[model samples]
Target: MEEFFKKYKIELEKEELEKFEKFLEIFKQKNSQINLSAIRDDNGIIEKHFVDSVMLNIFLDFLEIENPKVADLGTGGGFPLIPLAIVNPEVNFVGIDSVGKKLKAIDEFVEELELKNVKTLNGRAEEIGQNL
Candidate 1:
């Protein structure tokens, strides 16, 4: 996974890489208990989930916001949101999903990763967006 990330010039620190590795393990375990993701294997998770999510880094420069806050709608199992939050600990992230169970899994993932900058909401994006 570390080698794969380096191929994209996205060099993760040792700790960050460890967190991503841990996330993969947790994701697989949770997926076994509940349908969190369709990509089941390690390679799939790395390529389809983690790498895909990290690709959002390309837009970071365009954001042009100091200490940016982001909202990811229908962030099932915390795809872009979790990975983004992991890499950018200074930024804030909110992940909203319609399924309560999926949010629960995300909450567990957040806690397991010891992420302080993320929050999860179990509701439709429209309802939550309006209030925010």
Candidate 2:
């Protein structure tokens, strides 16, 4: 994972990097209990989930919003939202998923990672978006 970040020229603080490692550990453990992801191996998770999620940073310059508020609809297993929140702690992230079990697992992941800027909503995107 560190190599992946280095490949992209992204420097992560030690603490931040540890948090991502912890997230990956917890994700794998929970995934075994629930179908959080189909990619079971470390390399697959790193590339498909961690790297893929952090790819959102490429669009950050275009957003041009300080402390941007991001809503990830149908954010299964936290996906881009968790990784995005991890890298950009100042930004706010709201992850909405219809699967209650998945949301529960994400809640646990958020707590384990000690993420302060993320919140999960257990509801359909359409219904939740309408109310919001």
| Clashes (N, CA, C under 3 Å) per candidate | 0, 0
Best by TM-score: 1
Cα shift from native, residue 23, model 2 (Å): 0.9
Model 1 C-alpha lDDT per residue in residues 62-104, reported as the tens digit of each score = 7789988899999987889999888989889999999999999
| Model 2 residue 23 lDDT score | 89
Kindly provide the TM-score of model 2 when superposed on the true structure, using C-alpha atoms. Answer: 0.95
Give per-model TM-scores: 0.97, 0.95
| Runs with alpha carbons beyond 4 Å of true place in candidate 2 | none
Q: Could you say which candidate leads in lDDT? A: 1
Per-prediction CA RMSD (Å): 0.8, 1.0
- Residue-level lDDT tens digits of model 2 in 35-82: 999999998898789888888888975889976889999999889989
Q: Candidate 2: deviation at residue 34, Å?
A: 0.2
Distance from true location, Cα of 119 in model 1, Å: 0.1
Residue pairs whose backbone atoms clash in candidate 1: none
